[model samples]
Target: MIRSVTMARAVAAALLLLAGAVRADAGATFRAQFGDAFLDRYWALQPDAAIAVGYYRYAARIAVPDAAYRARRLAFLERSIAALRRLPEAGMDAAMRTDGAVLLSQLEQERWSLAEFREWQWNPSLYNVADAFALLLNTPYAPEAERLRTVSQRLTQVPAYYAAARAAIARPVREQVQLAMQQSQGTLDVFGEALERQLAGSALRADERARFLQRLRAARVAVEGYIAFLEALDQRLARDGGGRDFRIGRAAYERLFGYAIQTGVTPDALHARALQEKERLHERMAELADHLWPKYFPDQAPPPERVARIGQLIARLSDNHATPAGFYDEVQALIPRLEDCVRTHQLVDLDPSRPLAVRVTPPYQRGVAMASVNAPGPYDATAKTYFNVTPLDAFTPAQADSFLREYNHWLLQILVIHEAVPGHYVQLVYANKTPSRIKSVFGNGPMIEGWAVYSERMMLESGWDPSPEMELMYSKWLLRVVCNTLLDYGVHVRGMQEDEALRLLRDEAFQSETEARGKWRRAQLSYVQLASYFAGFSAIYDFRESLKQQLGERFDLKKFNDRFLSYGSAPVAVITPLIGAADVSR
Candidate 1:
């Protein structure tokens, strides 16, 4: 017994020595040393972001982060990066290495945005803090009175935040200025209409409610003042300077590509690739049009111009859209069908019990995204994922038709696939399951959006109602994806003006005038974001193909997909190595 004790102690001592030796060989694993503190600092700097991500610890305290605060945040990032650089990758496993890479990429992107782009000086949208305040009311993370305290506190700071915003504007973009003004109007409604009614009905003390109402009135005045300032800025710029160019320039755009597209491909390369795909997609669309020409127009001959032919084919499909009143119901009715199809094919795992609530988009969140998935914040366990479909009730008949045509019956299913089932809603649910909080909050736009677009193509491939009309609609949707990348560069780097963009969408992508016009504004209002849809889908799909080649006959489609998504929404570049490691281990 004594000899056995001695032998066990010797083995334990040797194992401890081995662990120490490994630690001495490498500095420390990233998650072990850097993750928690870094996340804490990130939340501290951007509490609004934390709130959006479902953290409610600071819900009652309104935060109006100013210019000096932003500068300090950038300085903090630099220090974090320097510290992180000293922590070698030697000790990390595949997952830890991936988390470290994501942090580095994120910090660098933010650094570039602050130090170089100086978007605070150029983008008026930065001043739109309404979403932060309004979110308190929209979410159910806290009790009524607790949420109201946040609304009250944030409202009181409205004038101060507006003051900081006004002082910071040096060379604002015209499109962003206009968008801010438009969004400000919606925000006013939030305070005047929504918040007012909310406060009256809530169970807050009389004194608290009275004081909150006073702050709300103050916020109204401040908002109106900001709106007036924007109007004057607009007129001055239009007559004298007309603001700065909306383009982010080639070099800066390429730098942005590094953050947004984790793939090593340059923006120039991506743009060129998009051009090639656009051509091919148009050809596929034309062929589908040829197949359907006789069905749509029994006796008439097909048009000579491919654009005209495709337009006619799309118009025929557009005739099947729901009316303004029934639009929401139609979208809601279509939900179960998509859910049923995804399950029938065993495409991806889903919890039928998981909450996917469909509703009309609030006024503030509308305009940019016709439909968007508001996934539950990473911190919120009980909140449902909202699939916000913008109502057509407010639009003119002509406007409604154009919007409906763009989202026609077949196209509607594709949109739903991209926005809800087996897309953003499903992927985000997977994202929330991951242990890394950083990956969930600072998700790669390319991967988040790319997966959705890829799912649309995958759904069609899985033999979900493989009709020619469906194929044509799907092909046209694919063109929109390609055109999105093309137009982003075109406007931002290629000096693409309004007419050129409109022509590209209508002629090449076969988008209606309504859709094209809305897209033109979206392309201007946003920068490089449009590219993510294509870049993400392309990289992810290519990665799948590579895995297929590597694993050969051993590759299982469902398993491959589930495995790919298991790492949350890390950049595909970061995700690639992990997948390679996983494949090797398997």
Candidate 2:
């Protein structure tokens, strides 16, 4: 009986090994047959997107985004979804299974955008071609002459691209049209000095340069015509009130929120959570403000109300900010300080080879966020990640002062932590090194934004600068994150008016008036995006705490952080299960 039992156990172990080997073979076959083909076709249909994602093979081509192209793209998505569903999942490894999920989500999202959301009909900003041209010029993935040649090839399509864009519009959004006008005008810079500088520095032959210059002129003409088209659209909409409302109502908002945030939580639930978070953060900020009241207002007592007290302290601290001319330079100086802090604390490993470049935000990409990190695609990990800061030179003195105060001394450090070292920049570096290409290319937005939000609080918690003033400012910054969700859900899902939204920002969130106004505009222009910060932060922070509880003393900060980021920007919901499974096995 003992011999028989041992032989049965041996047979079971052999079967398990055989199953694992078979699954590995199946995963390899699935990738070779479908995964590669899907991306190749996807890139061809989305040349601009391909360029953005480091697929340079289609650098010279541009999709017109007309009806025929939309139909083809839709067909491609449907076919790919079906093909993916037909494959048996039992034989796939965990990583490959995650890739399949990411790819499916991507395809489904695109199909929804094309079919239901239908931004093409109402968003004139969707048609900008200049940014792609600028990217082809800016990214150093290829040699100057070679990139220039590709730019010339791509320039030939600009006329048709804009023409198709002009034809595609039905009842366009007023704010979108205005934004398109600004961005399209700004795009002219790509053809002017930016292109001229590239031409001057290029090693192209004189004849080649002349031909490229001619193509550039033609593209410039096309862009100018498109801008004129937007101007006319704006005028007509103003006169007739024919433009569609910018607010995507609750149903659309909920759908978008689901796609944008893959978590099971509803938008209403997130909004409720954010409202509660606001109160919690307010209590904390008031406590910190009370602690620092004697330092800043040594003779005076604190205000009776929590909001007033917090606002009073933040207003006083706001005065300690950089000058308008020095704003960009101050941001540049903060990067090294942040890197040093991350290293000294041993928070996460730093890659010196992946240098971060701080530059003024390019003309074509301005008017939305003040600061953003443009990381290289997973395919091009060696390229520098740009920390793009919008220049304050264009702002009026009042606006500049307001903007400067909004990003004052202590909060500026938090912003650097959020956008640069140990935030989006560091997380992206790790994401690029992830093994699965699908996870990187189809990276989830909430996961990306959430990790940055998480990093800000994580830094202070880990003792980066534990001053009372820094703590108060961070509380204010964190309130902004919570309020981002409130503001977004309020405006889009709840029909929140501008005055009410501004009140939420200035009164509840304690944001500068300038910052409040900018956020209101951002809320209008972008749908369901601001929620990413809070949704992501809550998910990641909760997950970390849960793991810490599970592991007890075994939880290592660096290892948890590294492993969390190793999944390559998959949605928090998707990543949580994988991490939990790994922990269970351990």
Global Cα lDDT for candidate 2:
0.88
TM-score of each: 0.93, 0.97
- Estimate the overall C-alpha local distance difference test score of candidate 1: 0.83
Deviating ranges (above 4 Å) for candidate 1? 1-29, 550-553, 580-586
Measured with C-alpha atoms, the lDDT of residue 213 in candidate 2 is 83
lDDT of each: 0.83, 0.88
Instruction: Tell me the number of clashing residue pairs for each predicted model.
Output: 1, 0
Cα error, residue 435 of model 1, in Å, equals: 1.4
lDDT of 2 at 224: 94
RMSD of each: 3.7, 1.9
Worst 10 residues of 1 by lDDT: 577-586
Write one digit per residue (lDDT tens) for candidate 2, span 1-586.
9999999999999999999898978788778756767688889999988887778888899998789999999999999889888777888888888788888888888899899999999999988887678778889898889999999888888889889999999999999998999898888988897678779778999998898888888888998999998899899998988789999999889888888898667998999999898888888888888888999999998889989998999999999999888888888898888888888877788899999999888888998999999888876788879999998888898988999999999989989999997999999998899887888888888899999989998889888888989988898999999999998998897889999999999998888888999999999999879999989999999989888887877777777788888889899888888876245223
CA shift at 218, candidate 1, in angstroms? 1.5
lDDT of 1 by residue, 1-586 (tens): 9999999999999998887776555535555566666676677777777777787666555445477877788898899888777776766556666777788888888888888889988887777666667677878788888889877877777888888888888889998888888888877878877677888899999999999999989988988998999999988989898588888888877778777888777888999999899889788888989989999999999889988898888888889987777878888888888889888988888876567999878776766878998776678845778899888777899999888888888888898899987899989988887877767777999999999999998899899879999999998999999999999989888889999999999888889888999999999888899999999999989988887777777777777678777778888787777666255323
